[model samples]
Target: MVQSLAGMMVPADIFLSWGVQFPSVLATVAEKAAEAAEADGTMVLLAVLLSLVAIYTASKVGGEFFNWLGFPPVLGELVGGVVIGVSAFNLVVFPETGGNADNSLIMLVLSATAGLDPSVAEPTFEVQSEVVSILAELGVIVLLFEIGLESNIRQLLEVGVQSLVVAIVGVVAPFVAGTVGLIAVFHVAPIPAIFAGAALTATSIGITSRVLAEIGRLSSKEGQIILGAAVMDDVLGIIVLAVVASLAKTGEVDVTNIIFLIISASVFLVGAILLGRFFNDTFVALAEQFQTRGRIVIPAFILALLLAYVAAAIGLEAILGAFAAGLVLDETEPGKELEELTKPISDVLVPIFFVTVGTKTNLSVLNPAVPENRAGLVIASFLIVVAILGKLISGFSVFGVENINRVAIGVGMIPRGEVGLVFASVGSESGALSPSLDVAIILMVILTTFLAPPLLRVVFRDEEPEAAEPDTPA
Candidate 1:
């Protein structure tokens, strides 16, 4: 066989193998290699940008589609995330989602292509990343602050027993369930399992709020209970996160640290509320005096940033500070303007946060061929069911509230939104939970989020009162 030397060429697989082997070579050629490596980083950023754009556009498109089909818009968002996440389309690379991504083909490509030249791969701030962090923070702040501002303080006061019951069940069930599941089923150590349980204790109010708003049930009595219970849940979640962090760091749970965190969080929350109330008048006056439009925005931004820092210093999340700031603003007479101004920032920052979340969901964990992996998958499903059922039972707390649909309220409380993701992220970063556990948590969040709207619609279809029948003049 006389074959010309030119006739034989490098196989496509060989070129890929070469890229994997001599990563630096691709970056060194004519500096084309370097430029190309640099280009990949740029490509990553571009992919993120495109993801953000896709999510936003998808949300809109999904919303319309769902609206037309009489389904929840959130469902559409979930579908959008899943569709983009899976192999149906390869528009964006799914970032490592704990254990699941390592098995993914997309990640295989990302790993093979990761910064070919370390010399040229120095991380730089993309406008997108900054914008994403800010919006995510702002949206969270607005959401929490709005909850505080909109809180029916008087109703909470009046129905103290009910609120406490709801909060207690909501916190205790998940905590206990998660711990037992980890220890008994997964055979994880008790301490990590406890921390895992604590992570699951926090109820994400944002999901329920959005669902209620979507179904036009936000003003109902059941809605109020859901809101109250969720706020209480957030307070509980923070306490749990602080405790778990202390335990993880010290390698032993400390009652003293728990007490200290509770005290600190309580003081911060109460002080912020009082300060906001006290300064409500002053803030209004200052807003009027400054009149610079620009002045108010800057001052507000500074305040948010300052509080966020202080919150961090006190060993709490910075998002809490932003939320507290929102509450303070809500008390001021000029709050409406502040809300309007905050919207643009939210519009810009929030989507990045969400898409960033979606980006982290690794689809490869779904593979069962990996060893001990079946246990992880089973755990994921078990956890999701436990998470859902536990929250669903909390709806029974509306014992005497008039015109309340306990079912609707319970259903409304089902969705776990950004806050759930926060817990999952904390779990992943701290190594308290493995990628398998991460998959479990994420599945719970997605399931809850996907179920809320449609379930709420079903529960509220008849508009029956939330309360059981009362005795007549007995």
Candidate 2:
């Protein structure tokens, strides 16, 4: 429109003769305004705001439903993400502005307008993407640290062989089954298949822990085993991610690098154990010295973040570092005070982290026009079975541990919340997965997380009778 006005004008001298320059000024202002608007787009910001509102509302409704159904709120959170991304209630806009429905092209154009040349843009964006990614890394660290603090290290060690076996089975079975489904069944190449299996490897210990605590079984032997197995599962899962990621990047899975990652994780685990034992007295002393209000809590919080950062710096995930730090803290103090102090922080930040996960989910990937899709859904369905069965087999690991039904504990720990989704996201970002494949992983995650709790309630309902009757008469 502004160009039309400029074209219609014969000459500025005509306006000057009439002593009115308003038309020329209007044209210049309009042209500049249009140019500026095009340059500085607010599309992403608007889309984010829309998503935030939608997520908040969905979380509330989803939370209630999941809670009533005997599941964790994380299940609802996952569903909330799925609703926004895949269901009729999509919260995201295609271009996030304008009527253009081609988001991929829009993203490319917007990124190009921001000075990223197409040839160089992929690498540049991958590098810059690390900034937002640090958030998830931190979340994992904090989650693990909390687990460490809640853990009974001595007890976990006592149960080490059994827990290790469970963890190994938990990791291997799912990976093999999932890989076979992706490759033999779905016929994808080995590298991508391995990536899919890797995504299925994580077990959300946090979700399992919360549910165990809720059911007053945190003190049970079965609970202890589940917690221990989950810790090991995370350690092993990350190693798989590192190896698979390297393989995907280089097209060669280096056995030496895989061995090195495993060794590093083992070294870190051992180092954490020694440090916790050696400095436990010092930690207790420091807490005593800082008994003053507003002292121990802040320092401890700082310690968690510091360790988390250091972990990231070393190429390991921050969540693992946070968990290690928490393990090092002196939990011998009465009433689990360290955990009580940290709960407030976790309560506030953790939900935001999960909600952000929900926000990133794009549901439109289920659209029919998406390419190379059959394999993705087929693999996801197969892996969902493998994910459930692998954890279920952990129940058999309870043999010879008296008074506890290992089956129940295994079922309780089956839900894969943020951890599994994190794997899916990493795969998606690396270009190793198609959009439909990403959706399949998301669906598998949602299915596993949603089904676990209610199933657990039924599986363990029989345990009450065994508990009621002691082996020896009272």
Candidate 3:
């Protein structure tokens, strides 16, 4: 049968009665490849949309419950993140988190619900996680911009001298106390000690600014000083980070870079405000020409993004630029219109920033059951004390301001938040810090961030609560 079949001439287009094509096989292959790529891209977008669903659910439920309990909604948003994050349900874990996000409950649900291919699951989750992270970052940027819009520039300037004092003390005291005590008592090596000490100097401008705005004290004299000091601390924190990073890489600090960072930060901030003032009239005039759907907001957002980009290029925080953009727009005729438009956008995005801050935190580092974590807990205790007291004391360092809630100023600077993570990450990556010391810094950051919101409310409880969610500057 095989010989007969082989001998038979079956082709030649079935003896010229039929035809088949073969050369387009490569084109077919390419078409299938394109389809697969498109499918994968769609899956990534689906995954991101699902993640946002979980995020928004957590944020709102947590926020409402906490707000009902008479606490700051930000606290609930954080706790919500902790619940859904790597520490708990794994619903919103990041990719670097041991690939747990790919196997998270949300991802699994997505797979089961969508008939997602197992082969593409990993890449989809990775891309989804990254997109979420970028959105979270944008959230914080918008938060800072909104804050800058609400703040009184003249008021901040009024407390500028005091804020400078507070920022300097906040940086120096913790850095000295934590660094010296570690070397003297723990006998930690110089580099690890310095890196850990550097961790103490960060003040979460995002957290403090949100809390101040919530309690309606954002326009208060004390609030102005705290926000101003926090911004200054951010610039100083970057400088310290640069110095320590240089030391870690080369065992030498860059004096010239430090000087340049200082000068550039000052110039960037001053120039942003000056330019804003210089262009206020022109900005307003330009706005009058646009008669489109986003007439009021599009221009303002463009300015914010541009300034944020310039600030990053100059080695300063992008939020500073966004904040500067807000200040500039606030001086324009469209200031109120811009504020109204920004609120809805802030509502959508800012919660992602708060929630993600909680998600990235690994509470496992504080487990006393683990012998390794025990040492971290012990060291964390010391750092916490130093972190809290060092910053609190700086509030009292504010001189010539009578009847100021010096404690609030200090407490405002207490939360290390995500800024502390930058230091810990660098230390771990450089091998400058032992696992135990790294964990200790994480604990300090977590506790300080968790504690500051309630503490701020307590400190300001005596004062009348500012209008909850004030739409205009006080």
Candidate 4:
């Protein structure tokens, strides 16, 4: 039935192109719709709307299908986006190449103008791209915020020592392994090497959190440690990014600037948590006066956005601020209320984030048949192994946490996802990394993100009952 329904939805062109014609009225309506779309400058708008519908539908179907297969739904969403995006079917196309104006819708309009007036087309394609980018950014912020809502300061503090060790090891091991391995074995340039190393330092809290949530383990000890470690990893990753970006720009690392960045990030996170705790009740009291249905949600979301903005302003990732916002709100009288209210929004936005991440992954770079790209494939493969080993080693760093699944914690930290992409983007823009190196990093992100969820499921599946069982006499 499902296959038949899908078959019916295929365009009539496939079967009727030989000689068939629509009824006159139907043809007229279709013609008029096309003409109107072309005449009123609504082509871009129509494309955007259709793109959203297609993405959401595909994401839902793919996610559900993946879930049915005993895997995390997000894996399916990512795969769905890749299938629908320019990387596969080219159904939802972006500019063929980054920063080339030739693919802009405005440029097409300008061409139609025949040089009569070039100024008429105002780069509408760029505007549309920006809009989509903003939406993707919002999706990630809300995702982190949701993760934060599920976590509390006490849980973070309780796992503080172990998490700290895990985070430090996670960051240092990957960075050192990537930098040293690339330099010594691959003979890569120093700047690009550093960018690769910096990229390795990121742990996608979004991916890890979703996997834990899917498995109903978000409140487990391993979950808490992974979450806490991811938060620390974010701070450390951003600082490393800033330092590497500076080094790339100046050809030398400035010690003072790196110190300042670290201090600023630390203060921002610590300060946000402290301030949120001190003033959470006051904000909750103020929110009580508004008797509307979304009173709690509206204020909570605004705070999340505001803090996210502040975090971005301070050179940290905006999602960090959003996470901090969640941590702050999770302690208040309205904390649980806010989570219940904001869940619907997260549900809509978070899948878009994962899908967008998928769309950005260009699998063509991994084609071994392409001789030029084979080296990149080799580099990416090596970095991926390094990436896995680096994070996996961090799990065992927790000495005192007996019976804790250190392997689960390590696997949870493996997916680099959007954060690694961000590092790669910055490096590419800075000219710090060569195109091959950038592609390698992207491939690393794709592999890590794709593999972590299933590996996590395997690690955590049987351990749940064991973890929950009370201590018994042998």
Q: How do the predictions measure up, each by TM-score?
A: 0.71, 0.70, 0.74, 0.74
Predicted candidate 4 versus true structure: per-residue lDDT over 1-474, tens digit per residue: 001122211222222332444475356445434433333244445445655776787689888997797555666777787776646755444542352235433344434643312332333343344445556667878877886787666765676788999999999999999999999998998888988999999998877877777777777889888989987787677657766765675576567866776677678877998988777877788788888777788888888989987876555567778878888899998888888888889788877766765665566766888898888888988999999999999998988767889899999899987678668756764667775677688778878988998999999878643233232100
- Local accuracy by lDDT, each model: 0.60, 0.61, 0.76, 0.72
For candidate 1, what is the TM-score?
0.71
Clashes of each: 7, 6, 0, 0
Clashing pairs in 3: none
Off by over 4 Å in 1: 1-119, 122-160, 190-195, 202-220, 245-252, 398-405, 462-474
What would the per-residue lDDT of candidate 3 be over residues 376-423, giving only the tens digit for each residue? 777889999999999999999988868889989999999886567656
lDDT for predicted candidate 4 compared with the true structure: 0.72
Taking the tens digit of each residue's C-alpha lDDT, what string does model 2 give over 178-211? 8887887777777778888887777877777665
* Candidate 2 or 1, higher TM-score: 1
Q: Over the stretch 1-474, how does candidate 1's per-residue lDDT look in tens digits?
A: 111133221222234345475765333332433333343455446434554666677556765686587554544554455555543353333323322333333333434665323333222112223334344445555544444444434445564666667877888887898889888877887667776677566666655666566556665667767777877777667656655654564466567866787788768866876776776676667777885556566666676667766776666655667666766666566666776676667555554444444545555666789766787788878777777777777777657766556666566666666567666655654556666676677777777767776787788877643343322110
Candidates ranked by lDDT, best first?
A: 3, 4, 2, 1
RMSD of 4: 13.1
TM-score of 2: 0.70
lDDT of 2 at 456: 61
